[model samples]
Target: MPDNSRYSAHIGYLFNELPLESRIAAARAAGFSAIEHPAPYAVPAADMAALLREAGLPYVQFGLRSGDASRGEKGIAIFPDRRDEFRANLAEGLDYAEAVGVRMLHAMAGVLPAAEWRPEHRACYLENLGLAAEEAGKRGIRIIVEAMSPGAVPDYFLPTAASAREAIAEAGHANLGLLLDVFHTVAAGDDPVQAIHDSGETIAHVHIADHPGRHEPGSGRIDFAAVRSALDAIGYAGFIGCEYVPAGVTADGLGWLPRRA
Candidate 1:
């Protein structure tokens, strides 16, 4: 079994009952070793860092802004025209991460019309990733890219672990790695176990959510035990992020959490 200590609560998904500033304490109370957030821009970096310090928890990972959500832009990395925007977002994320003690940053590859996904888009993504990795590396930070499930985000640039792996290889940066989310791997019709094995050391971080509904573990068909076994097999010592929606109350659904000794 995976170590209970190797779990972090994604406050952006869990602990929705409380305000953002309060979720850090809630996660600590729930026994999570650490905490991560998808979007922490709303909270000033110094304030967020103070909360983590007060809660005695490390801020593990966080996502860069996915462009203008109001405009339905899931990401900006894949657009040659938005390279400036992508870099600006990365700089902002890096500043926040440095302040909050986060060592891993997730960079989302934005969507594009199916027919418009040209070689230039791929080239642009590689270039942007290389730049991100190099810049983040200077701070001893790692850059991660996740493959979103098509069912959840249509036209998402990287739609499978294989694709994200390919991009990582193409980027060829030691500081760049894959952010493997089991929900996306399974929902994309790929074996999560196989993905874990394939990603191995290239996986800088992980996210967990049940398939079919993206709900908390045990609410869907995913074999979380098997998932744990695979993670162990790969020697993934990093925290596994609880990035799922609660079927009911977030704390109530935490029965799935392995008991900590």
Candidate 2:
């Protein structure tokens, strides 16, 4: 647990594995005041709202499901073949975002192209975002895209800050923005903090964790204190999400953070 009050946890991959309500309970017990994850479309929206209220956690953020990369499916907005599906997903996401008080909706490149970056691929991605931005604007949710771990997702699109910046620029929509991930930055061999600073103006949300293990902030090879310092320097006022696995009990490894914060 981060002792700092400034920290929040993205009940990331874990939320999908547990009973949603139990996950919410775990988040609050771990000292997280806010929680973000994919909406439980499979679980009823009313049940999710009840869980959020009962757990006393007020925050939620999530991206719509992107299919497996192994299947060669690119994000609908990014690949021509998937455009219709992508737009439909966005509509569903917007409805849930509204019902659940989700403030951020990451336009995560759910799946990647089979090859490396392409001008054609980039065009599709930007075009898709342009349409989705209109939907996001109406719902009051920002559609920020995220970069995944480079090696973990090499063929996937949107792995670097530069590419995402370009895509957003071409899209030219205010509602379209960037989501920064520290674990992916380290995986890409870029200074996550510096990237954040350079992309600060365009940044909408930040995902933080230590690497090479993607563990909680203090337990990995990456210097999280430095990352936190860089974020502070950049005047980044967005939530710093604890998106890592715990070495022990999630609360045991994290309880110190809330006290210190």
Candidate 3:
């Protein structure tokens, strides 16, 4: 039997067939121990919290509002001119997190046009990250940054584990950590096992998806057993979020998941 205790169902990706509120009960019925979503603002926090409580599952992690996703803005944290917007988004995310008992938030580094990229962008990102860490720390929350693959998220500021590590070091906040996603790590040409080893205790959370297709685990080239081993080696005890698109029906694609018996 596969260990289900540490797996979190990312409802944002999985259960797309159902509405957000219904996804909670689906995750519980599907045997997930926890659930996460990138944007649940549409569902009131109190209602979401009540759903979680009724389902007996914890809401683990969610991303800060990426500024106007419809407008192609992945995030605003890396733009010097958008400081106010970033902080407002952070405050809103924190409020929702507190309402739902979540302690981790993914702070996305916004993208920039290739021609407009400048050193000031990095400086701005570091500054915003520091502020986010400080504010989140006040509420006993830890802020995590993940490197999204350029192929998937064009012009993303932080696109590799190395870049994310450099930013974390420069930011120098105890509450700041890394959210290691195996799919992005591999897509960026870095070895996921090595990333897990190098990140060590700085890894606050983990995401899993097979590369090449970004589908369910066994549908692609990633060796999830090795991923699990590396995570174990690093003493990572947090939830491993399933953040992949299903090849078919969500439940049918779950053959890769081990049964509880």
Candidate 4:
């Protein structure tokens, strides 16, 4: 086990071979004080909440309903014609967050064809985000937008933390912020340190995976030490979400987790 005070297990990537309850137990065993997931809509919210309480873990964050990935739809927020779909998903996500005591909701900007980046799309995105932020704010929850790397998700509307910041500003909601994924920043050819420094307090959450392989932090070219230093410089006191794909057993791949005690 390690001193995982600033770490949270993204169960979608860690111990994903197990069910939710088993994943929670594994995260606790591995010394994580909090947990997050991609989607938990399959299980009842009460059941998920009970599992977290039993494991003594707080729910840090979770993503809103991105449309079916198999159909090439990453999310609905920015799709001009999917306003109703986005609203439905937003309601569901907010309900789930309230039920599970999640404090942050990552509202993924949908992937669109390059030709379809029209004014309507942008307007729809900001409008939907504004509404989502207001609704989440009422419950003391924050709504965060993450930038997906274009290399991994081609034509993703949001492709860099800089762009996310601009969008958050346009949305004009105090509860809106950014979720800076270091892997995506590298993939977008942006310096992670600079991104963190520039994003500053707008970064309410973070996700980490190495650039070259999207694996454990130390398994690739990313200089996590430098990244940590930049985060420290910015006075970031949030969890560093472990969202990398494990090379083998998830636990065996956690060599980068600090063993403070």
> What would the TM-score be for candidate 1 when compared with the true structure?
0.97
Number of backbone collisions per candidate: 0, 13, 0, 0
Better of 1 and 2 by TM-score: 1
Candidate lDDT (C-alpha), each: 0.90, 0.72, 0.90, 0.89
Superposed model 3: Cα runs more than 4 Å off: none
Query: What is the C-alpha lDDT profile of model 1 across 1-261, one tens digit per residue?
Result: 366698899998899999999999999888788999989999999999889889999999988889888877888898898988888999999999999899999988998877888999899999999999999999989999999888888889999999999999999999998899999999899999999999999998999999889998888999989999998898888999989988888889888787767
Regarding TM-score, does 1 or 4 come out ahead?
A: 1
Query: What lDDT is reached at residue 152 by model 3?
Result: 86
Model 3, 1-261: lDDT tens digits are 139988899999999999889999998888889999999999999999999999999999998999888878888888888899899999999999999999999889888877888899888999999999999999988899999888889889888988888899999999999999999999998899999999999999999999989999988898888889998888899999999998877888987776666
Q: What shift in Å separates residue 251 of candidate 2 from its native position after superposition? A: 2.4
Per-candidate TM equals 0.97, 0.89, 0.97, 0.96
Name the lDDT of candidate 4: 0.89
Error of 4 at 188 (Å): 0.9
Candidate 1 residue runs with Cα over 4 Å from true position = none
RMSD of each: 1.1, 2.6, 1.2, 1.6
TM-score of candidate 4 against the unseen true structure: 0.96
Better of 3 and 4 by TM-score: 3
